[model samples]
Target: MPKSKNKFGKYLLIFWGLFITPFLLLIIIMFMASKGWIGEQLPSFEELENPKSNLASEVISSDQNVLGKYYVENRTNIHYYDLSQNVVNALKATEDIRFEDHSGIDPKGLLRAVFRAGKAGGGSTITQQLAKNLFHEKPDTKTERVIQKLQEWIIAIQLERRYTKEEIIAMYLNTVEFSSNAYGIKSASRTYFNQTPDSLSVQEAAVLIGMLQAPTRFNPARNPDRALARRNIVLSQMNKYDFISDEHIDSIIALPIELNFQVEDHNFGLATYFRESLRNDLLKWCKEHINNATGKPYNLYTDGLKIYTTIDSRMQRYAEEAMREHMTEIQKKFTEHWKNKEPWEDHREILEEGKKRSDRYIRMKAAGASTKQIDSAFAAKTKMQLFSWKGDIDTIISPMDSIKYFKKMLQLGFMSMEPQSGYIRAWVGGNDYRYFQYDHVKEGKRQVGSTFKPFLYTLAMQEGYSPCYKIPNIRVTFDLPTGDQWSPVNADGKYGGMLTLKEGLAESVNAISAYLMKQFGPQAMIEIARKMGITSPIDPVPAICLGTPDVSVFEMVGAYSTFANKGVWTQPIYLTRIEDKNGNILQEFVPRKVEAISEETAYLMLSLMQGVVQFGTGGRLRGQYKLGMPIAGKTGTTQNQSDGWFMGITPELVSGCWVGCEDRLVHFRTLELGQGARTAMPIWALYMQKLYADKSLNLYKGDFEAPKDPLNVILDCDKYVQPGDNKTSFDRDF
Candidate 1:
C-alpha cells in the first residue's frame, strides 16, 4: 500500500508540473511584453504620456494679424454654437454617465466587457477613448490594440491631470469623428441637420449622439430607419438614466426628424474650386516657409492649422443657386421639346437612351465607320438602325431622339478689395469645385477679349489722345510675324466710316481701336497694360486693340477696381490676421496701395465703359436690370466664340465673369449666341441684382475733361513732327 501511494504521488506531481509549466511561461512572456522587453521594444508609459513631444506646433493667428484673408464662418447664412448642454447630456446618457467620475478605464464595465469578450475585451473610459482618438497611433491587430489601449490609459491619466472635466468634454466633442468626413460635433450638426449645436432639438441631438456608436450604420442622411431606431435606444437610455424626464423622452420620440438639404458653410458652387486653389497656395506658402527653415514637408490638413479664407459665404451660395437654376432651366427647355414630341413616360430613361445612341455614334466614328461601304439595300437598313425608322418606309426615322443636353459649364470669379485697405472682400474661383479646381479669377490665363480695350483707351487718353479725337474707322489689315494676314472686324462685320474716340469706344469699333493702336504705337499699349496690373503676356500687335492679351479675371477685376477707387490700384488680400493656437500673433497682412492711373484718366475710362454698357453690346443688361447706381463694364468675345468675358464694377464692388468650354471649342451655334453680352453678362447682372437689391449706392455723374490735342502729352514723339521749324510745328499742332 505504501509503495502504491508513493507511485501515485509521483504520477500526480508529474501531471501537475506538465499543466502549470506552460501557464507560468505564458505569464512571464506577458510580463515581458508589457514591459517592452520582448522582441521589438514597445513604447513605454513615459513616451505615451508626453503628447506634446509628438504633437506638431499648430500656427494660429489673431483676427487682426491675418492678411489678404477674411474670417468667414463656415456658413454665413446660419449661426454656429459650441456643443450644447442638451447634446452633452444626451451623449452622457447614451455613452458614459460616469465619464467624469471614472479613471482611464471603467471597472464594472470592464468586468462585463471581459465576460462578454472572453479574450478580446476593451475597457476604455470616455477619457481613454478621447485620448485614443486624439493621440494614439492607429492599430490593426488584437495585440496592437492592447498596446494602444495601454498607451491610451497612460495618455488619459495625463489628460485628466492637465485638463478639467468640461474642457475634456469640449475637446472630445471637437476632436471625435461622428461621420466619415465629419471630424467633430460642429461639422456633424451642420452637415446632417444643417443646424447649430445649440439650436439642435432633443431628438436631433440624440440622433447625432447615437451616430457616435456606429456612424455608417446609423447615418441619418443614408439610413433614416436605422438612425431612428438608434436614436430611440439613446432616448430610452437617457430616460432610464434620469438625464431627461419621461415626458421629455416621450415628446422627443414623437417629434419627427427634419433634415435641411442646404448645408451651412458648405461652400457650394465655385467656392470649392476657390477653396482648393487657396489651399494649394497656402500649402505652397507653408512648404516654402518650412523648406527655408527645416527642409521638411508641412501638411496643412493634419497640422490643425486654422485657415481663414476670403470666400463670401453669401455670394458663394447665390452663385451656386444661380448656376443650378440656369442649368435646370436649360434642362427643362430640352425636356419640353422631347415631351412635346412624345408624351412623358420617363424622361430620364429617354435621356439615357439618347445618350446611348450618341455614345454609339461616337464609338462607330472612332472605329473608322466612315471607311465602311454598304449596298443600297443594306444602307437603307443601316440607316434605319442608325436613325430611328417610322412604320412607313418612305419616312426615314432617327434611331436616337434628341434629348436636351446642357453641359455643366460655369466659370465665374470675383476679387473685391477695399480701395484704401486692400483687404479682399470676397472671391469665388468657379461654379463647381468638384469639376474644375483652377481659380479662373486668379489663374485662368485666357484672352482678355475686349476687356483690355479700356487700358489701351486709358493709355491713349494719358498719351494725348482726347476722347473726342477723330479716328478713321476704315478697313485695315496687318501682317503677322508668321507671314499671316490678320484683319480685325466688328461684331456685325461692318466698318463705320468715321468715328470720334468716344464713339469708337462706345460702339466697340475694332477698326477705330486698331487705328488708335497704330497712332499710339504697340509699346505704349503694352506699357499701359503693365501699369494697370496685367501680369500676363501682352502681344504688342494690332489685335491688342481688341483685347487679345492673355490675362485672368482676378487681374481684370483689380484693374477695373483702379477705376472704382479713383485711380489707386490695391492688391487684393483676403486674410487680415493669423495667430497661434496659444493666441500668439503669427502674421498680419497690411494693405498696400499703388497709383496706376490718374483720377482724370480713370474717370474718362469709366465714362467710356459706362457708355458701352448703355448703348453697345451690353445694352441688354441695362434694359433688363435697371441698376440704380452708375456702373461701368466691358463685354468681350473671342474668335469662333471660344471664350466670353465680362468685367463690371461699382464703387463698392468689382466682379468678373467668363463662360466657355474648358477645351476652348466654339460654344454657341450662332452669332446671336456668341457674344459676352449674351453668355456672361446675364450671370454678372444676376449677381449684381442680388448684391445691390437693398443697398443704396451713390452715383457719379461727373463728366471727364478731355485734353486739347494729341501732341501735348506725346512722349518724345519728335519723329511724328511735320518738317518745319520747332516753334512753327508746336504752334501748328496747337
Candidate 2:
C-alpha cells in the first residue's frame, strides 16, 4: 500500500470513532426516550390533542360587561387573532426571534449556545417552553431533569407537527404564568394594565413579555425598576428585529411602566354580592351538568363557562351608588340614635354566638383549647381591618371588641326586577361582600314588616273585595291556638272612624289588614303568597297581618312584581344563559310566570297603593324627592324598629329595600329615625333618580297599566266611597 493512503484511512477511522458512533448512539437514546422506554413517560396522542389547563369561568352581564370570574389558576383563553400585533412582536423579538423560522428546536441556536457557553442566548424555542409549561414538574435529581429535558424536546417536536405557528404562539401565551397568580396573556393584560390582550399598547405588551424571564423580579407592579430595565430590553430587541420603528422605540422606552394593577379577587368589583350569591348555583350546575364531548361534569373553576345574566350594568351601578349615598346617612343617624349606648348591650348572647363562629375561636377549639384560653386569645389585641362606611379601618383591636364593633355595623339589601319578565336588573345583597359574606337579598330572612301587607290585600282583591270596601279601623283581637290574646298595634296608635280598604292600604292601617286577615286566614294568605313566588316559611297566625313573618328581599321583590305584572306572577330570574369558552351555548333559562289574580284586581291594587306615595308613609318619594312618576310604594318598620323596608312598583320595575343591623336587638330605640321612609325610601328614591337621569334605562317614567277590560273594581274611591253596597259585609270579632 502507498504511504498517503494509509494516513488518510487512519484519519477517517478516528473521525468515525469520535463523532459518528456517539451521534448514532445519541439518536437511538432520544428515540427510546420519546417512546417512553426510558425513565419518564411522554404525553400520549390524546393528551397532546387536548392539553389540560385551568381556564376561569366568567360572569357576563346583559350589556356584555364582565362582572367577574371564578378560577383555579386565573387563566382565560383568547383566540390567536385576539392578540395585539405589538404583543406578538415584542414576545417573539425578546424570547425567540427565530420562532417562526424554526420547526420545533433551533439547531443553529443550540450550536451557538454550546460553542458560546450560553452567553449569547438560550437554545430553547417558544414551542419548547410551551412544552415545558404543559408537563413540567419539579424533578428531585439531575438525572430526572435530563430525562425531563429530553421529554420536553420530544413533546416540542410533536407539538410543532400538530399545531400551526399561530396556534403554537397562542398556546404559549395562554399557558405561561405572568405572576400574581395570573396565568395566560388575557389575565396578565388585565392584572397589569387593565387592558384586554387586543387593546395592549407596545409599552404594556413589553412589560408583560419582560415578566416571563423572572415573573416576580420583573413584575411591573412589584419591581418597577427591574421591570422598566427589562421592558427596555424587549423594546431594543423589537428595534433590532425591525418589528418596531426607531421613533416608536424611543417614545416607548422613554415612558415608565404605567400599570393599573388590580389583582383578581372575588370581593372586588360591581355586584360582588350578586356574584357570590350566584356561585352556589353555578357550583351545583357544574356538578349536575355534563359536557357531552368530555363525558364528565363541568368544573366551574376550570371549565371556562360564560354565564350571561339579565343584570343591567348601568342600573346596578346606580343601585350601588344610591346605597352608598343613602346608607352612609342612615349609618350616621343610627350611631347618633344609640349615642352613649351599645346596640348589643341587651343582646350579649349575640356576641357569644359571634365569638364561637370566629376563626380564632374555631381554630383554638379544634386544637383542644380550654374556654379560658379561647377567651384570652380573643382578648389579645391584634392588628386588623374593620369595615366602615368610610372605608376599611385599619386598627389595633381585640377580637372580642371587633365582634362587638361588627355587631353595630348596619347592613342592607336591595333589588330591582322587570315586572313582566322577572329579569333582575340590580341587586345589592349586603353592605360589603368582603366584610359580610352573608347575602341579605337572598339568603337572609328578616321581618318583612308591613311589606307583607300587600299579599293580604292582593288576596282580598282576588276574593272580590272592592278598593272602596269599608272596614272599621278598630283594634281586632285574635284567640290563638295557645289560648293567648294577640292584638297588633299600628305605627301610630290612633284608631278611630271607618277607613275604606284603599285608605287603609294607603296609610298601611293595621286594623283593616287584620279584619281582612281574619276573613281569609293565614293559610289562604300563604297560598296566594306562594303562588306569587314567596318561598319563606310563614306561620298561620292572624298576627301575620301586622307583618310578623321573616322573609328575604328576594322573596318580597318577586311577590310584589305579581301586582305590577298585572296579576301575572313572574318569578325573578337573573341568569339568561350559559356558554362554553368556545361560545357554544350550554344552557338557557326562563322565568316562571303564573296568573295569581285577575287583571282588574292588579289594576285596583296599583291604584290603592298609589295613594301611599301620594299622601301616606311613602309620600316622601313624591313630596320630598318630587319623583312624581306615578310610583306605588309601601314603607315598613318592624317592632322595636328592628327592620326597615320599602317596596316600590312602577309600570316597568319592581324594587325592594331592607335595612337593619345583623341582630334584631341592634336597632334604633325610637320609631322616628328608624322608619322605612327615612331608612330605606331614600335609597329607592336616589336609585330611581339616577335611573331616570340616565335616559338610557327609560325606567319609572310611565304610569301603571290599567286593566285591558275595564271596571270590574272601582279605583276612583272619591266617587265610590258612599255608604251603600260597599259597606262592611263581614262582622268584626272586636
Per-prediction TM-score to the true structure, in the order listed: 0.72, 0.93
How high a TM-score does candidate 1 get?
Answer: 0.72
Identify the runs in model 2 with alpha carbons over 4 angstroms from their true place. 1-26, 33-35, 38-40, 721-734
State the lDDT of candidate 1 residue by residue for 1-734, as single tens digits. Answer: 99999999999986676566446655765675677654243334553442321112222122222212222222111112366777888887876777877765566666555456645434566788788766666888998776566556556776787777776776667656666466567667867876768878778888888888788898888888998999988889889989779767787787667776433232442355555566666767667544222246544543334455444555555555554454344334334434444332433454444444455555765666552321122233223321111111333433333222222233455454444555554565665553345677787777778777887788877765655556667877777889998877777787656576667777778888777776777888888777767788876777888887778877787777788777888887665554433345545666567888877677667777877777777777778877666667888888766677878776667777776644354255355665777767777777766666534322233433333343342222343343243644331222
> After TM-score superposition, what is the CA distance of residue 714 in candidate 2 from its true location, in Å?
2.6
Model 2 root mean square deviation, Cα atoms:
4.0
Writing each residue's lDDT as its tens digit, candidate 2 over 1-734 gives 68999999999886565556436646966687667676257787888988878899999988888889999999999879999999999989988889888888876776666556668786789999999998778789988776776777778989999999999999999998999989999999989888999999988999899899999999887888999999999999999999888878788789977789999889988999999989999999889989875899998998889999999889999999999999888888887877778776766799999999988888999999999999998999999999888888999999999998888888999999999999999999998888899999999999988888888988888777787777888988888888898887766899989898878988888888989888989999888888888888888888787788999999899988988887899989999999997899989999877898778778877887898888788888877787978788888989888999999998889999999988888888888888888888899999988888887766656677777675655556655634455555332111
Q: Relative to the unseen true structure, what is the C-alpha lDDT of residue 169 in candidate 2, on a scale of 0 to 100?
A: 92
lDDT (0-100) at residue 73 of candidate 2? Answer: 90
Whole-model lDDT values for every prediction = 0.62, 0.86
